[model samples]
Target: MKNSRGSLVRPHPLPGSASRPVVTPLSPSVVYASDTPDALDDQYEGRVFGYTYSREGHPNGDVVAARLDEMEGASGGIVTGSGMSAVSAVLLGLLKQGDHVLGGNQLYGRSLRMMAEDLPRLGIDTSLADPCDVDAMRAAIRPETKMILVEVVSNPTLRVADIAGIAALAKESGALLVIDNTFTTPRAFRPFDHGADIVIHSVTKLLAGHSDVMLGYAVARDPALNDRLRVFGVTAGLTASPFDCWLAERGMLSFDLRFDRSQETAARLADHLAGLDGVKRVLYPMRADHPDHARAVQLLGDQGCNMVSFELTGGRASANAFTKAADGLSFAPTLGDVGTTLSHPASSSHRALTPDRRAALGISEGFFRVSVGLEDPDALLQIMTDAVAAARAAEG
Candidate 1:
């Protein structure tokens, strides 16, 4: 018999059973013990399938990574602590000090800053170009350009890039084509199908469908590239927590249903708000008046995205009024919640950019981005109408 201290310190695991639970069990252990030194060595060398430490990898992360890889049609991938970390792993891991990166100017503000500002300090050069124009991107690429980063549909603005065109450009220049697919998940667009070398996602967004988890993933088409990213991710300590991975997996179970309903509602709201009073412009990829309408349809199909961006006639004051007077929607700095929410790009996402840069991207003080949720379509429309009226009154 063991002493009380020994018993307390090392409790025996429950008996193993053949029956499996319907849901994937969450294994939160930070370290795993191998039966033998040989077994441990095999795990470390990738000679066998297992894990030694959570930072290197955990079971949950692997499961989620595999799921995302399958969804994106990738051979393999890695999940990271956050979306930015995933992007960081790719850029920092692949590029040398003197390498250049050609990126889209209208990516999420943080991503834009990372490429345009942060990478430059590290001896890496970057150039931002129009995402929707292949010729503009081609003109920006240099001989040293090692990576071409872009998004299918830009954030806060509904500009759609010609992925196939940019992919061809990357191939010609011997640069890796990396795409951020957060705005249009695999449900709407699969970057890999269009020749993307790497596809990234902010899993905190629509992938998780809840405002709860902050996770991200990068899927690589090539197994060798995936291996490099995994090494970098492990070394940089960018591995995701087990609980977040579990939550993301659970959220994705109902992703299709939530995505369809919310997408439908977003389409309804964007169309209705286009001609409404106090609205200067509505930017929905599916809208005929949108600049990328044709390309968006060709790439994203008729489904469109759950996000809607619009400009208020009164600028900042009208935006503030609209948020204040809006019913059933709250002003949030983040998005991808089951509940509808609004984001002010000028103050929140793109506040770091200079006024000139922000203006160049068409992000005015009056610009508003909405993440339509699983709400009644008729009720949401009425709420939007009433809010617009209230905003106009406040502006007047």
Candidate 2:
């Protein structure tokens, strides 16, 4: 017997618990109770598995991390608030002052900016080089190089890196190779299979399938390095909310189905666009004309990727017209949505780069990146064909 308020605060416990539900219950509690001080100490000290605080350790994050670990074939992993946060945790955790990073120039623009601009401010030097050119990457590696960061498939331009070749380089140089596998999820390319020390993913995209959740994670092949990343991730306050983690896990339930459909559609879309009059060059990893076609084949098999980029004959005006005429198609700044979407590099992902830099990377004003979705291939093809006509009409 207790006062009303007291009774309300501490409700009667259900003798035990119901049978486990199929869907995981979201535990969004910021803090959890401990039976005793020694128990909590043990939890914090990693003597046993348990949650103390959401920011430090939690059930939801652990579940998703474990799932990703199994998917990426790693012993351990940690989920962060976002993809960039995951990258930040890895760089800050692994490297110290005076260490150097040799990063791919064609990585996601934000990632490249972080390595080239932000890392240097922390006394960590970075050199940007073409990851496709293994010889150039080897030459660029310095004695102090502590990390070799690259993407499985570069963003926007769709360049495919030689993961095994570069991994060998990293090993020879005694540098840890960190591969960003956002574009090529574990279903397509598991970096661990090719000697990658660490694999990172923006689970917001393909892993989650839908575009609703914002989550990311880093999986480490070595347990020691994974533990270090977890410590830094917790210290840096990069942990994600339980709700987001739960949603991401739910999204992954249908990952294989969504990935396979979108990838198949993207291959067809690339072919359709290539034959259009207003298109200059279509950038799809599997395309025979693509410079990295051979490497892409060896790495990704027949399924290249769901992302496709192509240049319009009329540049920005043509792109503007195409989007305007292409009714029902979303012009999202982000990628990996269930529905087909378009992104303009000049305005979205690579907008921060100088004009010369954009040109050097072949991200022209006319360049449009398509995040192929679960839409009907024939319907998407028709929409694209009409849009190309509109683009040409505007150019004239």
Candidate 3:
């Protein structure tokens, strides 16, 4: 319920949110038959009733949201304009003043900012811990803790969180486990299957597939939470547009195929980087030397995602040079697109994070994240390989 003016009001419900919502179309779009001059009065006719406001729910918006919910096998899901909006909607709905949010230190930068500064201003407190250290996470929880936020595969550095272990801890503490499954999309990981209460995504990256539309969603396993979130979404006016949702729906069709090829590219790259002369570290979640490879294999099973992170032999400058020299891959600020994207986390995605915080997270000047695309594997390899070589020569 939204408290505004003088009274609290219930938000309009979307179809498929329940077993069935009596969705009547907006004033009913007319379907004309060759012989009919008047509208049909039959039950099969679409309803004239539709969303009075987009904030309540758009028709296409609900359709794609339902698609995502079904995909996640969630009780329900809500789509938002951007990934950060999805995070904001959930955090704002569930957290209040004096509440605590525990996030993994390796979280997406935007998320860290939202929890650290945005939520705190509303009286909620936030903390972060090394996700690789289950003991650290256990120690971080307090009586006021309401949520544990983590990425399925962490940002900048692709550290894999122990989802099952953390979910258990969240349950014990009576806290909700919210997992950002953007990097590892449903193609790679299903957070709910591992015990997460909520799964979040930046559809602009993977789910949308094309890097064309910016969208996000939060999927809930709990029916009550799903209903409450929908109300909050409608009342607060934080909702996704119909067009973006439509684009996302279109993108979902090719998800499995695109990621399959991208993963193959990522594996080859991770392997190649691990042995390369100028590479100091490769942080692919599936790599054996990664801090969470065992858990990744256990959690991800066979499908490891397309994102790969590595440190340049030199530092930030070298990383920039390499990314600039790359031909096939665009140096965009996002991931999970159909084409490859490279970004310098310290300056781009995680820019909101303080220098000290970024340093602590190991998003160094030398660190670069590569989002493998659908480009030919050999071409991508050559482009990336050449980028590194150029950076090394320039630095030398």
Tens digits of per-residue lDDT for model 3, 149-222:
99877887887787777988999999999998888888777788888989888888887889778888887888
Lowest summed lDDT across 10 adjacent residues in model 1 is found at 5-14
The better candidate by lDDT, 1 or 2, is: 2
Best to worst by lDDT, what's the order? 2, 1, 3
Off by over 4 Å in 2: 1-8, 11-15
After TM-score superposition, the amount by which residue 83's alpha carbon in candidate 2 deviates from its true location, in angstroms, is 0.5
**Each prediction's RMSD to truth:** 1.4, 1.4, 9.2
lDDT of 1 at 147: 96
CA lDDT of each prediction against the hidden true structure: 0.90, 0.91, 0.81
Q: lDDT of candidate 2? A: 0.91
Question: What's model 3's TM-score?
Answer: 0.86
Q: Name the regions of candidate 3 deviating beyond 4 angstroms.
A: 1-50, 354-356
Which tens-of-lDDT digit does each residue in 257-277 have in candidate 1? 999999999999999999799
TM-score of 2: 0.97
Query: Higher lDDT: candidate 2 or 3?
Result: 2
What's the CA error at residue 349 for candidate 1, in Å?
A: 0.6
lDDT of 2 by residue, 266-299 (tens): 9999999999999999999999999999999999
